[model samples]
Target: MPTEKQPVNFIESALETLLIEQNALKILSTQIDDRFSQACEIILQCKGRVVVTGMGKSGHIGRKIAATFASTGTPSFFMHPGEAGHGDLGMLVRGDVLIAISNSGKSDEIMMLMPLVKHLGVPLITMSADDSGPMPKNADVALTLGHLQEACPLGLAPTSSTTATLALGDALAIALLEARGFTADDFARSHPAGALGKRLLLHVEHIMHQAEELPKVFPDTPLNEVLYEITDKRLGMTTVVDHENTLLGIFTDGDLRRLLDKEQQFNVHTPVSAVMTKNPSTIKAGMRAVEALQSLRDKKINQFVVVDDENKVIGVISMHDLISAGV
Candidate 1:
């Protein structure tokens, strides 16, 4: 601890810590050998969840690793080793796989639960600094983090070791994700309220204005009436359809501005079809909202006329609507 009497270089200290941890992660990458693949193989064949257990700082990292696995298609959860010694050992079932994290490979709390875990026939996977300790000796697959040089000035704290462990955990989780052929859509199903979920799961029809809420007009409708429809709907645009409700074109507020600039004598009584944009890009009602947003960005357009398979107008989807829907 630096006092007011001594000058401290905070930037230098932080940079040193980061560099040390980064090197530890680099070393950890090389340590990924046959044992890593064996662990993944065991997990891939598991019929039950992955139960993660650790103590102290390792516990915190274990929880995060378990969460990543859970969200990425693998079923996983964390169990406190200390708590497992009491009644929580029941959480470990026969088909489940156990991932024990202990930098020293000899956490007393974790070692105490090994007998019960083994009796349940759970395949043990251990992460530690090396494969020399009891935890790794008993594991079905021992993932060694290599020899890490701690960033702590006293070399008493777990710095580089924990960072390397986290990196190794992420590597393992992603390997399983790829092996399982997990997709973005699959990930979205597990996170329906997240941004990615909204983008993938929310469709055009879910957020589009339909029925009377859509601003639509016949091709022969007067320009002034089209502006009224646009304002009434507050969508900044209106679809121009024929008598059969088959979309012919679209008219927007921007068209009004350009019409004013081009025509010396503007006539609000003129047919909107004469000034409307012909064959505007349209989207199906079932299309994903994110696809609509991508189209908007690609074509430099703000909205789409939602149409059916027969090109009949069903609804209208706007950029504002997509944004509001959290797509």
Candidate 2:
């Protein structure tokens, strides 16, 4: 068999593509001017949702852009122009904003939607390489993202152009995000199922072990009894509570080690209160899990007593819990 020509170096090819994309992005960045601001203003003033549309690869990027906008305080959704021609255009309302993506600015599918979009009095924003094309001429605001050669040796594939378009979409979304004064908490609210949301929105109450699951003993309980509760609960610690079940203090594995180092016999009957740290660091059930984790780190503690507004012990949360949740 003829030896196969050495495989085209895939890694080298990929690096070259990335370098081309970077240069393309730089060119697009320098082109950002008053038109970009005008696009942001149009989207900001839109009373209805943003409807993004395109064909082929541009369609995929448009869908992602729509999602980013939706999750970042801008109400948006993707509309396939082909689907729109087939009755999906009914989804567009009078006040909605339309963002049409086409590298060449002459996609037949996008051009087909322009008249309807105009008739509805919706603002049309076109992202295209050609500023003079029909789509740009019809659009209320044209975002010209072009002037870069493709990375493909064939020069037919949309390699650098798509990258530039994606970056331009990001810049637009971020500008709108800042203009809306969107914060991490606001982003977390929109993405409650994601890791960042878990860190920012989840609270001690949502994860802490409560009621009978809490390892607790009266302050007067013997140290051995406190150890028994700790072992039975498997939290490596136990809370010392008052008669009304209010948190008085906490004892942990660290405290046990210190006691052992002090030569205290395991059988010695010391009061649990004597071995516990009074008013140990605690967190409220409603506090954000991320804030709780920060408190734990700042105080150098592994466990926190979850309490109610009245200072009654509700539950306990460990550093391991936050870590397990990827917070």
Writing each residue's lDDT as its tens digit, candidate 2 over 216-312 gives 8998888877878989999999988898988899999899999899875765578887778898888888888888888899988898998888899
lDDT of the candidates, in the order given: 0.92, 0.90
lDDT of 2: 0.90
TM-score of 1: 0.93
Q: Could you estimate the TM-score for every candidate? A: 0.93, 0.88
Model 1, 1-327: lDDT tens digits are 875787769999999999999999889988989999999999999999999999999999999999999999889999999998889989999999999999999999999988888898999999999999999999999999999899998998888988888888899999999999999889888889878788878999999999999989998899889999999999899999888999999999998988888886788899998899999989998888999998998999899999999999999988888988888
User: Model 1, which residues run further than 4 Å from truth?
Assistant: 1-6, 194-196
Q: Could you tell me the lDDT of residue 274 within candidate 2?
A: 76
Give the lDDT of residue 275 in candidate 2: 75
By summed lDDT, which 10 consecutive residues of candidate 2 come out lowest? Answer: 263-272
